[model samples]
Target: MSSKTGLLVITNPKQIGLVLSSVQQKVSKILYIQLLNALSDSASGVHTKIFSSIPKYSKEINGIYTQAARHCKHLDVRVLLSGMKHNLTKIKTQNPIDIVIFDKVFSQTEIDSFLSGKISTLTNNYKILTLNNTSEQNSEELVPEVSSEEEKRTFKHGVIGGTFDRLHIAHKLLLSELALRTDSKVTIGITDENMIQSKVLHELIQDLSTRIENVRNFISDICPDLQYDIVPISDPFGPSIVDPTMDMLIVSRETLRGGHKVNEVRDSKNLPKLYIHSVELIDEPERDPAEEVKISSSTMRMRLLGTLLKPVEINKNIPSKPYVIGLTGGIASGKSGVSHWLQELGGLIIDADKIAHGIYKCGKPCYDLLIQKFGEDIVGKDGEIDRKKLGAIVFKDRNELEKLNNTVWPEMLTEILKIVRNATEDVVVVDAAILLQAEWQHYCHEVWTTLVPKEEAVKRLVERNQLSEEQALLRIQAQPTNSSYAAAANVVFCTLWHKEYTRQQVQRAWNLLRERMCEDVLANCKNC
Candidate 1:
């Protein structure tokens, strides 16, 4: 009856059926004891469900999550039942949910087998997030979501969830936004990589430990008061359906689209949709009107190789033609420090935030657009936009943020590109946290995430911002809780230690990037 902790638990179909039967029947003997033990050991919280074989178990679990989603606007849940690993090739044509479950944990060897099967299968260009365990302990910790051997299920209170691969500023910004908007505690889900597939993604950077650690660190630093857990679900739809005590599900534009699709599927089954709390898109600062290209991890990578255009004024500071480095970090991970270092070295910092700031300055089109959509209420007395009020409205509610972004992204991208084209600096850093999430990785010469200790980050925010425990907690909540963003980044800078250590890491990375850039330039010269 109290708020429940959202936990992602995995189990084999047969085991799930037995466990459900035992729970429903009020069996208190050996079978029930074993079930309890299993649940407690593997997962904790009311957001627990069985991944089993029996048709009856599936029906019961589905009904529970669906009912939860309907009664509580704060909670969302669903169950992943079908799709074995070998069936991935047929994912597009078969059930989409089933396909995702299959691929979520496929090994390289399994993938090869699928590719070589007689069906003449083609690899989906979409990049699924992946984590490779290096140690035995890690292997056990990073076990794929499916389990033939089950664990006990115990429910905790307070739940929040998100797909936080490359924990960026936008993500943290939203989390911070949420903590401010709600009085309830929070829990989160790191969207299973299987469900997230994009045509453009390629490399899988920073494994699960890094991603989890990033999330742990970010949350510990930003929102220490809120109880947090890494809930594991095969798809966004599942946890929202079954998690009984969950009050709400956090969503962004990308995830919203996925959740909507999930709802459509659920509706076909005559089920209700999950209650979702949508976060608004954090608009990257705009560039000059003449600058039209978008900023992204991909674009940043391309720019670094001289295969893409430079930003406005980015080419002016260096010894030779500008060398653009894609700089990114987890929410509140001190990307500014890295950018400052690059600037101190006489390199140009083609700041995404600054460009975004330029876009929203007085007399810009974004201002007019915001006024039209959200009205003048969000504007301050000085005729300037009120960021806090606007953020509150957008991040707490999904539809509003979508409307805001639809108007801004096109124009924002155009302006950003123009800046890139006119840039002429020797070393320009495209400082964007969501370069990958924005599908901008193709443009980056290389992408990096600011890695920091969650404890240190918490201390820094509390000290630097002069915020109360709760306020600083909210700020950290506003970013990515983990390194899920690593899937999209090429490199990461661990900032848990001292600032000097961070600088040293950056220096080494910059040196390597420099060599790669030189090679790329030479190759281009030959082609010319």
Candidate 2:
């Protein structure tokens, strides 16, 4: 019923457990079987051919095929045993089966044949899935087990491998769903160039460290219990599958057939069979009805090249690319004015003051922390912070100020780092008056500053804020001195009384920043 609700896949064997781990279902309960080719007396099952000459290989192949045929007489195994192996249809008729799964080593010709319908008997009702093609005789297809509810309750341990290029939300979604189904820990083994051929694509996005970091962050954020690593995955079957302690081998449809070849090797070694699990077909986003067309990294590159007129919709759910710019200015300077300009320019402004305000609003953690460190005087009557009172206490005493910085800096940095880590915006501005003081310089690539003479700044404060000249001076003194911030400035603007001139200066700086960002993107692409 329902054409078997669980997935039926034929591909490289290595991805079986990954598929099972993805779906979070058990291997045995879901028809977890491997597709294999055995040398029978030629389709008629008359006499044993090449395999018969080798007693062990002959027995194992015969046994597995015999078992599969007894239950599935309609199944057809392509003649992979012959040196001149051809498509399943190319061979003379042998066994009459409901579905014939053709097995060919990984090869471009074989892939073309299957996809082109040259390999017959395929319909919407029956499908063929495969792994990366290598040589003509290297193709392998492994059938996945149909995952079921009963298998999920029991804890299962599995190991799987992959290249895992550019981690995305789809991967997290697939992993989380699998974890939900089984009480199991999925240990991921990733492949590197040493174990396999390098995957070369035009849009090389991230470096190895960035890719691994993305994978680790995804695992920690979404499925902390799942184990993962960058490891070798060359053997047709992973080393874990042969180990007695390991249970099932997890994989995707693309890797199922590789498992069959592994079985052939295992038969030679007399190793016990390892259960296989395959992941269900994840419909490509291109096929989505809501999305006019699916988008991929390849598609993004096409858009960048202007080969494609419209941008494909890349999955927005995953974290966006990192973008950050450092904005700093001295006491009574026009940093806030510059920050506002950056906002108008469509830059994400992460002001330290805003974070502090949030902490004060979140209440307890910051409130309790302040009171405990500075005594009850810091708390106000209306259940809000009296900024003047708090400022007075800390501004006067260096130890008090240091203590305040110590108390607030950790929490502030934590929040800022989280935002920076997940930034997807084209450009983000880190508006920190005390950026140099707070050690935020290391996090930024460029610094923009606003400069005004101490006397002029003081005059502006008195006139605009209605503060007395002496009060303005005190506020100015409270900020990090101008010389301290100058050391870190990559671009500096002299704030003038004329609003038009100041605006022009800001607009020029923004245009320069945009140019720099585009250059950096282009540089990264070239390196990739």
Candidate 3:
């Protein structure tokens, strides 16, 4: 192939890098490749422009540009945003595109239109090439140890089991293979909490519902016609031991023993053994010369806890409205009263407790997770979470409380940020009992905590819930004190006085907030 300017047309962003690599190998010298795609616009007519930078396009196009830049770092690259009009002659005259490449197979009509002498001035000058269409069997052959023959075998009902925590590429590939091999249905058994405790960073394992939903969505995306059943498994065997109708069991190399155990258990039950289909484990290349051989969930979890997981980025550019405040206090510290006063003063309050309650409803992910972590006793007769039972379990043990916090706090922060982002009010208050403990103060401009004496809180609880003095005191002792709140608070409002006094304190805070808003507006004006 001659060294010439090339124009490549690709539909999928993922194919950009592969096409660029192929073209670079074929050409003798470095090629200047212009990636062309048309954007739909009603106002702009036939406007063809080149992007000078990668970040100036939509996210999808930007991803393609990034991939192309990485693959062709030593070569010249530009992206052309084509308009509706098929002005091939104008495009060729402006760019001197001597070689044209199509990443996808084109129909006869498309080929004729592109090579037509009436429209394209370079119909005779440019060399046109189309990418080779690779079959699924060829694609499977590219994987080192995977055989296309195994994937071609079909089963009536297939069984596969895993914790499926923090679903990654390996899990997706495994599920996709199972879905493709199963003709009627595939049973996916996600390990329950009991089985997941030995896994790395078990606290970060997603809830059962989340794992099931993720697997379902992934299989549907890969093989939409296949039917799948996702269920929680408390043991290694899962449904394979009991479901005599299952014809196949899919397992990784490491879990081949478990597959055999399932067959043994089935033999004892007088059921036929399942046909075991083993898949090779996917391994990552060694980062260091003396590194481990395999990549597993433990390694992924360690990476996530160490460096892969980053703190949520806060946007410094403030929206037009909503100066957010994080309100925190100990139990029975009168935060509700303070939030009420703020609402009366025209501040919109988002109650994190209310949001948590909604999240903990029966059939919700949190509810099921809580039940799995705790016991059936934590659920009431009506099948709802019994707050008293859960409180008793957690409030007495600090470690248990921390476990609960680790599970729920991230979700709470997400919802709180979403509410603040969409709030139309000038001031928005997030009232959460564990606001400082959860580190949600990062989402707010300021932290405001309510404080009341321990004795007063105990007395209020005794009167409010008709509890004995000793019981109320135990509840108060389990929580952080007023001094702890004051340590993390930007503003502390002592709520020991009457309702009017509490309202007055809120009024003063509101006045300060208004002043801050005015100062912000003035600073923005000065900058403008």
Candidate 4:
């Protein structure tokens, strides 16, 4: 009897050739390959190009498939494109599959789902094989470059603390050093949700359980023999301050001061000061020379957010009904008042900020991506995005704010364009504070910017938002200057003067906008 094997190739384009070759040697007869294409679902809205055709695959995947088809002529191969909702019954019934192969390790739930009904009854008869499809480029072993001279010393117990958001090379290096230096065991204190609120991209920080698991995994992968304890810490001093059993504390050079703070707290409690060992920060040779600062979780989050800078090129063939004007200004610069004045002038105003808020709501396209890029802490109990919580994270840091803009700007632009195309109005004003920063000038026929002096803007923010002078200054400083806005503006409205003066400026700009709109309509009609 010819033995048949059911191969479920959950592999990428690069690994398809190797997977087919390996499977051919194992199975003599029919090879059922269930190619998992994530683009089948609407959830993969970003990847619309991948699932538009039959036997859905990218150009690269198609090339691989063609090559595999030519090479594996002896083997009867049937390719089935699967989405999240997989069909297991039809494949088993038709082929009498004796063994199932998975390119990637499936979760217990997936395993259970795949091996349900009669297949579960005959446990020993059928076999499952998991193939590692990870490329050698990504699987390059990280050999520690740090000097191991001091790592010879052993301690009874050691404690280390950090946010450990995404376990990067630096994090792995730190954990490895701690494990090697410590004798019996090491205790790791991962910063909790409450504690990480002040951090840069705090919303992007992983949950306590995930962070702990990551730390545990790194420790296990590096030094499997080393006993370690991973705990969530609400404060800087988790168990280090209270626990007298810990003999030493390990920390990076940047966090060396924190180690001392722990010692101080221990000293105040009449406990002996723990020996502090500060590990030198590992250099990220992969990063650009300008960005070669200390390897940190903040930098990692920033890098992740940086990937979203360039959005997918969307269809720009919008209707000529609405002549869009991009309006922008600094904080407390009376840009909202300018927008209100424009609205009164019979222009349909589209608030990009409000649109952004709507897009951030639960079940929205940008919502889950935002949660993945930021974190769940930014989401409220009502399942809506907590703008105040989000603002708290981005407003303080310029880079963090830019990261946020990078993530949201593309989605916001796409939405704004969609709205503009469907509108019946002759004129539309897109009021966005980050209009210039987001490079939304492409969508508008003309750009208008409102300006106010730094000092006056600060004073208004303090009075309006009930914030202290320092807090108000921070908010003002975080935004682009009036000069920056003026550079991008076709019409610059100085809002420092009286309401009448601002209105006069708007009235003159409105007259010019009307003339331009007429010209645009005529141009579109001629083309049509």
TM-score of each model, in listed order: 0.39, 0.39, 0.40, 0.38
Best by TM-score: 3
Error of 2 at 49 (Å): 99
lDDT per residue, candidate 1, 1-528, as tens digits?
111211122223223323232222221111100111122222222112322322233233333332322232132222322121111212121111111112024456644443233112123432222212212222112224442231212122334455555554445544543443334455656656564443122123324456667667655443344566666556656555555555445566555776566556655766555445454443333422322132222222222221111222323333334455567765567888888887776667777766666766679988888888998898888888887778668755567867866766666557656666687666667787655545454555555666554556777777876656665565556555544555445666655445675676667666766776687689879999
Per-residue CA lDDT of model 3 for 1-528, tens digit only, reads: 564556665544445667777776544422433233333321122212432221222333434445544455444444433321222222333335576676666665665555452223343577777786522232211113333454446688998999887665456546645654567888999998788865644544667889888777556543455577889999888898999789899888888998899998999999999989776555543322222244456545433321112222344754546788888888788999999988988899999999888877897768888888888999998989998899889877888888778777777777778888888888999999888778777777777887766777888898898878887877777767665676566666756656765676688778766876797789889999
Please give the CA lDDT of all the candidate structures: 0.47, 0.50, 0.65, 0.66
Task: Sum up the clashes in candidate 3.
Answer: 0
Ranking by lDDT: 4, 3, 2, 1
Choose the strongest candidate by lDDT. Answer: 4
RMSD of 3: 19.7
- Model 1 scores worst on lDDT over the 10 consecutive residues at 28-37
- Which sections of candidate 3 miss by over 4 Å? 1-321
Off by over 4 Å in 2: 1-321
Model 2: per-residue Cα lDDT at residue 248: 54
Alpha-carbon lDDT of model 2: 0.50
Clashes of each: 106, 36, 0, 1
Better of 1 and 3 by TM-score: 3
RMSD of 4: 21.2
Q: Give the TM-score of candidate 4.
A: 0.38
